[model samples]
Target: MTRVSDPSAPRIAIVGATGAVGNTLIDLIEKRGFRYRDIHLVASARSAGTELNVDGESHPVRAVDEFDFSTVDLAFFSAGTEASRQWVPRATAAGAVVIDNTIAYRMDPDTPLVVPQVNAHELDRRPRSGVIANPNCSTIPLVRLLKGVEQRWGVRQAVVSTYQAASGLGHPGIDELKDASRAALDHPDETYPAKEFTPSLAFNVIPKIDRFLDSGFTLEEQKMLQESRKILGLPHLDVTTTCVRVPVVNGHSEAVWIETHGVVDRTELVEVLAGLPEVTVHDRESRHAFPTPATVDDPDRVHVGRVRVNPNNPRAFWLWLVADNLTIGAALNAIQIAEELVERRTL
Candidate 1:
């Protein structure tokens, strides 16, 4: 196994540095104080030569084909599955430990799909393939909150409906929404753009996220169920999800119902979730007390609220959860894993 001897200062590379997640990862690495001896910004051919400022220094972005990955100690990949599929093997062969954000390897039995706060222990086995998988943006917050509950009361089943933001598709999705919104405002009857997201998304919501499977669940929805079970080590855990694309451009929100094996107590649920360092519970009787998708902007915590036991089933409870899909859900989670590797000296 290739291990990074010096945790304080390791050479780093950022794949798809021109993307939203890649940009956010650069900021988070600096904010979290992960020291790096050197940093390389890599993108596609079109994005090459673009200058990106990191920690007061301007780094020129180079095409992945032109960049050398062998010297870098750690590489964070967010260039989509196609790019990841093409470069990940080359990177691993060149001795760089890859933390992939794309779906290319998340379901691979050999690749450990992880959210550090929830399943850092899985990293003990290390990566024989030199690749670590980051869960989907929708799966991160759900699992983060479920981890504590699964530990305390043993969750038997969970159902989630996610209000995903336009940011899930990066800048293109955000731009499409904005353009459609403007067109609708200017001409109420005219048809606007429908590119990234199917069926208009400006002043509406789409119930589908990724391609639909024969099971009637979209790929994005199935990810929530499948990835949750994997990270929590509950193969039989009954999980269902419906992923929706909302107009919001920052955070993702979910209305979750969970059934535990034992009885559900509201007070105990709040205490257990609040005790987690990475979760924040904001619940009350007031109208604006619960968390909203726009409220969690670039946050590190998974905001959970509306904690209550279902009247029909004493063993079941409902929760409203919100989180920044770009940060805690993506970039920050990857950074946490890298930091964990450093602290454990496993990278």
Candidate 2:
């Protein structure tokens, strides 16, 4: 890999500095050592002035309303959808590249939905609106792992069951689990459990992730369907997803079943996946190893395992995949896109 350097390096700002994804963004940016003239951390006025250490120095988080994008060259927006909806246009109008990690602008035909490993070149399109939208958390890893298969078998359809960690729903998700657990153990006689989740998440499972759409699928499930197609440039691809919230804290896992245009053997798919750098294949018999969150939790590599065809379906393949939704799904992809931009001389 060649090191990227920007002689006139531009200042990079991270919106939502106090959020989980925001903290991950700061770590990834410094770890890659990307060239930047300065680093600015911005957040809501409530979080402003909070002290955080960056590159060994302590800096205070600034208020979003006080930021002057005129001086920043790039900004990563991990704030909620409402904030992105309100501020993205202003930052873009000021000539600063905005990589938004929200549902607000992802479906817009004018904004390219990017997963660096899958549809990074989509960023080369130079959106008329000037913002690049990152895919939904669960969709990012799934799309990349499927990329190798799509190259050979040409995936036609998919069905995925997700075991999403509580963090996928943000702070409220975590708090709900904590509150429910506390109430259950402490106040056993209490009538109601925690109220953050629609369903009790302490010891139960949530089959629904987001709001239900007219098609009867949750918003998260539909995001997987639509975002995967857009990132893969396969508009007509069929996708069905069951997104669930699990008790796990950080990593996201999926069981994917894909029908391809041509026949594919399980071993052949494993071979192709093992060879991909971004993908880690864990199908060992002696050690009884198969990809899991414990193995591929924080790395950019997506772990793939349990490769097998449906017992009767010869034209399809089934597999297990895992990755850190925080790293590969959001922060790392954003950093990789910036690096690619510099490499392609398109930054």
Candidate 3:
């Protein structure tokens, strides 16, 4: 790593700096005024030489192959899984700790899969692998709420269905959706060729998010279960999910059914959810109570509503949540991990 005069404010590099999450990271860094000695933008060769502004300064994007990871103390990798698999080791080997925002190292024994609000303790010490893994976007919000419920009532099992937006696949997915939707409107009979989403996400919802496993669950679904278990330290946590791709452009929504060991009270449940850091809960009283992706005022927070206890079973409750997949699910989580590392002097 480059010798830093101020350890608290380390030089940082953003791999995949031209992608959706990378852009969100830049915006958050500016909005939150995250301190850093230097910032480097790195992306694929195709995006190299392009300029993107961060905190009012224009930074030319450098090709990842040409970027020197040794010049930075920390690197945030929001590139796809394959890119992360190929480059994360190089960054870590160069002595820069990596906050990987992909599924690549989440299950690795030495790399801690982190959701800052739920498992900031994991950042107290740097990992043996020299990398920290950001949990799945859908998994991030779920685990954040699960941590609170588990602590108060002891979770039994969680069943979730995610309404993920096109942005989960980044700009290409968004572009495809917009193109397909326009085509459908103009030519209702013709089919739009969809590369990002199967059967087109124009006016339909696809039940699968990622590749299907032998057991029939999509990889996205499995990520939620496995990542949740790892982050919450509940090795046998029974969290099953159905990951769906919806037509929306940005935020991801989840309908969660949580069965806890103890009886749950609605008022206290609302209080617990609302009390969590950066979470907003909408109770049943208001005229426009529940939060939707487009309607939610605060993008940084996890918005939850429709809290209902199963009448027959007091231990079971259901809730709906909306979170910005690019921010809360990706960029913000990675930034939070870095912030925790900085605060704990673990980097």
Task: After the best TM-score superposition of candidate 2, give how far the Cα of residue 262 lies from its true spot, in angstroms.
Answer: 1.6
Question: What is the Å distance of residue 81 in model 1 from its true position?
Answer: 0.6
Output the TM-score of candidate 3.
0.97
True-structure Cα RMSD, model 1? 2.9
Instruction: Say which prediction, candidate 1 or candidate 2, comes out ahead on TM-score.
Output: 1
Task: Write one digit per residue (lDDT tens) for candidate 2, span 1-347.
Answer: 11235456757889987888888887876687777777888999999999987777787999988889877878899988999998898899888888899999999988888888777777665677778887888999888877888998888889999998877766667777777777777877774455666667776778998899898889999999999888988889898999988877678899999999888887787788787667877883322567677666547788877888776878888788888888887888888887776666565
Summing lDDT over every window of 10 consecutive residues in candidate 1, give the lowest-scoring window. 1-10
**Model 3 per-residue lDDT tens digits across residues 1-347:** 22235657989999989999999999889887788889999999999999998877788999999889999999999989999999999999999999999989999999999988888999999899999999999999999999999999999999999999999999999999999999999999999988999989999999999899999999999999999999999999999999999999999999999999999998888889899999999764652489999999888999999899999999999999999999999999988888899899998
After superposition on all CA atoms, what RMSD does each candidate show versus the true structure? 2.9, 2.5, 2.2
Model 1: per-residue Cα lDDT over 1-347, one tens digit each: 12124546678899999999999998887787777778899999999999998887889999999888988988999999999999999999998889999889988888999998888997885698799999999899888888888888888888899999999999898888899889989999998858998888989999999999998999998888889988888888888988899999889999999999888778788888888877878873342467887665439888888888888898999999999989988999999988888777776
- Model 1 clash pairs are 4-347
Candidate 3 or 2, higher lDDT: 3
At residue 263, candidate 1 shows an lDDT of 84
Evaluate model 1: give its lDDT: 0.87
